[model samples]
Target: MAALVPFSLLRNYSPFMLARPFIVKGCNLNFSKSVLPLPCRRLPFSARATHDEQAAAKAAAATADSGAPTIFDKIINKEIPSSIVYEDEKVLAFRDINPQAPVHVLVIPKVRDGLTELAKAEARHGEILGQLLYAARIVAEKEGILDGFRVVLNSGPSACQSVYHLHLHVLGGRQMNWPPG
Candidate 1:
């Protein structure tokens, strides 16, 4: 197993910091805090599935959105075992099986209510949406990544909306690049 290097040693940012990178699982990942925050939007931003996330997207696409129950339903119903990070009456959060970041949690509504994807959300779904986003914040806080974290919602296959069920991915613990996919 790879030992964790202290973040304190890499606090001061420098271009040369890239040379002596912080090692995680044998990969040199820069945990710098120099990136700017994305602008706020009235609507949730759609996360595009990139190369690293293609497998998840493909698996999700294979299932499609035929108004069928998903694996999340199993998780919500206690049929699936998950490392739950947080849970409430309206939402449930748990660690991602295939995590993209050191801190990656998926927050979803306990009741799908036709919210197979963000695009399918109706006005009646407003309350659940707010609850989901708030739960994401709570997950970030619990994970000690509130200072810098990301909430991603992939709406469709093109955007890599895996599982059909609406879910918000709370990701942090490292420097996240812009133009996220």
Candidate 2:
């Protein structure tokens, strides 16, 4: 049989309350208590296996593709759901579905204009390019991380840019390290 412990035994009663106790207040003290069994712990091997599977899934998702109309396109079109931070006629800033930092946001142009990657940027892309940078600043201000923030653009497979569409990553809310991994 399990032991039945009283709630009073868990803590000390206030001396002030004991001294000024009154019965003028009509209150019912009757109550019932119940104990719940602790949940079973998973086996170490099973737990490790589950963790490995999750890591593999995340890696596969992050390194999957490039230069195609990704899920972000759908998000831009309002066909998919995303936590938007800022939006203008030319640009859109939204929270990354998978955050790398406390404040991880992606800022992109509403129109691609064949800017599959930063490497493909031409002299004509100058206007929209400047607009994207300005949008990143707006996003940082809105997220309350204006004091300090980092903007990143992973270009091509070497840089681990899974999505081909041009986008800027704005990250903050923690001490940033130099020479990004």
Candidate 3:
């Protein structure tokens, strides 16, 4: 014989129109009373969101720009907190939020001007461009990776650059392999 569902579960939907019945395999066949297991309680909304979903939401919010102010602006203005390793009048170096290496730092020009990416650079950007590269070396020395390190710039979508503001990635602190994945 089929078991009758409890009134609490039945109240949420039409009992007759329900397609599938809740199956409780190991429980006793007593149907005179209703008892729900502890696991059926509602969970908080945050608990329901997966780690990937939360990361995607953060990435989406960070990349949703129309040539406007970015998180780097806040970092430059000292409005948002960042662990700065090196700073000069022309450039600033700070830790990357999602670091791919043990020692990962981002070197950027304090004044972005119109440089959203390396591809956007012009002849007038030569001075700041050199300054940024020099800052990267200073950062490597400060981080104690002077023996060896790597500098990278993801220019466009093909390179998987999520941030538009131009910046250089300085990575070290381990045996780095050639030809990055």
- Against the true structure, whose TM-score is highest? 1
Give candidate 1's error at residue 49 in angstroms.
11
lDDT for each residue of candidate 3 in 41-122, tens digit (9 for 90 to 100): 3432234534444565456446544667778888999999999999888899999986756689999888878887888899
On residues 1-181, what C-alpha lDDT tens digit does candidate 2 reach at each position? 3233343331222223223322212233221332322235343336585566556545544644444566678899999989999999999999988676679999998888878679889999999999999999998898899999999997765665666678999999755766665
C-alpha lDDT values of all predictions: 0.77, 0.71, 0.73
Candidate with better lDDT, 1 vs 3:
1
Cα RMSD, each candidate: 9.8, 13.6, 15.9
Give the Cα error of residue 21 in candidate 2, in Å: 46
> Between prediction 2 and prediction 3, which has the larger TM-score?
3
- Show model 1 residue runs off by greater than 4 Å: 1-20, 23-63
How accurate locally is residue 154 in candidate 2, as Cα lDDT from 0 to 100? 74
Report the number of clashing residue pairs per model.
0, 1, 0
